[model samples]
Target: MDELEAIKVTFFQECEELLADLEGGLLAMQDGNDDGDTVNAVFRAVHSIKGGAGAFGLEPLVRFAHVFETLLDAVRSNEVPATPDLVVTLLRASDVLADHVSSARGLGDVDEAVSASMAAELKACTDPNAAPAPAAAPVEAAAPVVEASVAVPAAEALIGADDALDDDDLGFDFQPMTITIDEQAADVAAAAGNVWTVSIRPKSDLYRKANETALLLRELARLGPIEATLDASAIPPLELLDAEAAYATWTVRLETDEDENAIREVFEFVDGDCDLEITRGEAVATDDALAALLAGSAPAPAPT
Candidate 1:
């Protein structure tokens, strides 16, 4: 391969690792783990990528990376400082970045809108006192809402899920939603920094290979307190059930000190083998709300 091609390949490989670390590092910071080395590692990754992109003259990549790298440097030098808002913004920028790279690889500029939005957001995030860097405008939309209503995408600095559906190449057939939590699960969740409700459907190959849905729920229990409710409401009984298919649907209330990521980590071994949706839950304070205290604290009064 030519030098440019080699660099591109390495860039892509290293970038994937970098992005993963960036995300994990950001998450760590959110949970009050401010490790300077983690922040430095993320900053270096962006800086290196920007420098390399500049040498290669990939304008789009270099342009965005310049702004992104600036924000990283700001955080690294403690010029801007990391706040929860900054962490969230940075994470969203990471998504916009995924869109940018996809466009670079010929994904048809699907994310120009997002890129512009993030660029504006980043500009506001850096310190005015720091040596300033060049800026890029957000990508413009051709058919913007009206002839006169173009809201400028502002620039600023740094910041910064799951649903499983029967997804085809074109659209999706959403499965039913389920929620559950047992007393033991509540205790576990109360102990943890957070808990989440997660639902998953096994992949097509999973059923054919004898993967048991029940077993997945049981395994999830070990990570913390877990109560599993079977959503067999969709199941057909007796002779009508598909013998080879997975019949048990589950809704789990998991309690743990784990962050959103750690909650997702429980399903690590089964990834791509199943579809999952996990949302961070509202912080449940006090155990009386979860225990079977029907007098006044029974989760909206047991649905009447």
Candidate 2:
């Protein structure tokens, strides 16, 4: 094998070790041994795999690992408490992550539906409003829209489960309405631009995890044109500065057609490691918010 091929093989071998660490750390958390060290270990395992996968251009593995690692990051930062149900979800996510790694290594194909479901579950743990990422199961057009309360118990009692029926089998006609209002608005937004003001202030933990603000800015640029300003006044003097500590904040005015969720997704992996505020229409003074964060004071009110 060539040198590059050998390096790829070595990365997958290391992935095995990382996956083991991920599983072990999660199991420990499930058993109520969830201390700082255990959470950090779990975060590191997913983070390391994500970094290596990006280098080799394994997009599927990288995407799944990114979602998985985001939840772990939230748990590590204590933004999302590590509860029993969440721990169970994390365990299932780890299994899907392993399947991604195996598929990347050409060992087998992962069920796309299952992987999407796991990614959605992980994301939901972080943002409860996030809908499931998997495509909805197709429903037969001819089936009657029976009352959910009555149909569920009736189906359970009669056939033990509900199955799709043909129009002849159902002996009823069903009409469906097509709603286009949301779809039309989305299309209009795609044609017209929306402006968003985003402010980011990174804490020391953001740098500690090897995340870079520059890369985030670059990713934001992919959505649209952005004007970014850096505030370095918070930095202490050179002699007092710590290399691992982050002191810079950024204000970005972005003009894009993307929705708020797209903008938020850019910072998902850094969830609690930084202070981020996204505003549309009138922008808030994020500098005041940053100051409040540093001083442990209430944030300044938004202008009317």
Candidate 3:
């Protein structure tokens, strides 16, 4: 096999390790050892899988993992109490996440309805007022990939005010945020004719629901060279921070020959959760243009 195929194999192998770590960590939490480290470990496992899946353009895997990771973040931040019910729901989510990974690798398939139902249950855990998820239908034989057009109900609507927390008082520092961009490669891609400029601003509810900013950025990188900059201007100081709100936006300059539809497809599942705009443009000047783009208020129009 070529190097690309070999790398894919290694990723799956590593996923097995991550899944194991995820299960063990969840089990520890279930056993009443809900320490910070355990929560972080569980979060990292899902984050790592989402990162790798985004790199490989595994959209379905990334989408579900984002939801799973978001829920874990709420628990880790203590916004959602780590009750037995939440732990049980998270454990089940972990199982579904593993199934998604397996399906991505062509080793197995998962019922879309079941995954959606479980995702709803996980979302409900973050809301004190939301009704409990209805009983899940009995598992049926694995079906074909869920139709991309079918709308999964938005989970953000389930978040309640009680789920929001003051970050300063919580005494928990968030993991430092970073964006990975291959500048040298992007430079070369920019010189080609296929470059595009993409801007994304996710609603505060997006992060509240546990959607991942980093994973989405990584997913865009899968299409071609990407130079991303996080717009932190809107972020309030720690003393004023709302732990559950999304304050940062991203401006990514993507260099790819793929048409607008292809780039838009990267965010298909998150359509309503974010404000996205794509436009054809000259190669991005990494230094000046990236800064200006991130600071600007309006994006250019899409290529006709």
Candidate 4:
């Protein structure tokens, strides 16, 4: 696709992911669940947005992303530890970035004061010598990137409110049906039932090492038997690499009677992390998994 097409696709995909990532970061920070994956996830989203904006010659976006990327890099590489204070700062930054994304689409300019506050907060979080963040930037030398990570006691970490969620809360309603897949799809497909195909394309530079396509396919298995055909037509040579972004798209055919809501739950945590479509196929007989799923209590055993 051309730049315009790519831009449209990226904005739609990026917005979902950015918010999901922000949610994860907040949850991790609040729960004291400082896993590398959570931090890396947030960083990768910011990094990809910055790279794309740079390619499109969007200076205002590029500028904000540059500073934001630096902060995320620090978090990802463990330069600065994940602190409650930093998490709050990042959340505020997320709002600013959201505005930037909107402004890119001709929404309006982000408030100058909001932008200024973000700039000041970012500097304080990244710099040790800087006095507490004021309403303006300081006239000090740039902070050098530290080599080692900071270790903090778990008890000292800041916490967030625990938001409870269950499968039902997540829109997982198991409605079973049967759909047929093409005979030629046997190689990619593991089983045959109600077939549903999904197409996924991840933002470039999403994964640090392996592309998310393969990783993404593995995760799909949790929902049902999914057949994924790699579209390597756009695949570039390893030498010309944007290893972070995944250009390869997959046509995944899943065999199950799972309803759209049930199937959609598979990609919930990854909202905005991918492009997707789900379509039905030929029908067949199936059990009432939905009845069982929707039933609050189990049926009583037959009298023996």
Q: What are the TM-scores, per candidate, against the unseen true structure?
A: 0.40, 0.53, 0.50, 0.41
The alpha-carbon deviation from the true structure for residue 142 of candidate 2, after best TM-score superposition, in angstroms, is: 38
Flag regions of model 3 displaced more than 4 Å.
Answer: 128-199, 202-304
All candidates: CA RMSD (Å): 23.0, 21.3, 17.0, 23.5
Can you tell me which runs of candidate 4 are displaced by over 4 Å? 1-6, 129-304
* Model 1, position 175: C-alpha lDDT score: 35
Over the full model, what C-alpha lDDT does candidate 2 score relative to the true structure? Answer: 0.77
Candidate 3: tens digits of C-alpha lDDT, residues 1-304: 9998899999999999999999999999999999999999999999888878876767778878877877788889988888988888889899999999999999997877788788677666765574454565676553232221211122122222344656553665433322334555544555666778788899875554445666576667767656676779999999999877777777777666678987886775475689998888642444444444545534545469
Worst 10 residues of 2 by lDDT: 147-156
Regions of candidate 2 where Cα sits further than 4 Å from its true position:
1-10, 24-43, 51-88, 99-113, 123-131, 134-193, 280-304
**Ranking 1 against 2 by TM-score, winner:** 2
lDDT of each: 0.59, 0.77, 0.73, 0.60
Best by TM-score: 2
- Clash pairs detected, candidate 3: 70-210
| Error in Å for residue 80 of model 3 | 0.9
Ranked by lDDT from best down, the candidates are 2, 3, 4, 1
Please give the TM-score that candidate 2 achieves against the real structure.
0.53
Task: By TM-score, rank the candidates, best first.
Answer: 2, 3, 4, 1
lDDT, model 1: 0.59
lDDT of 3: 0.73
**Which 10 residues in a row give candidate 1 its minimum summed lDDT?**
144-153
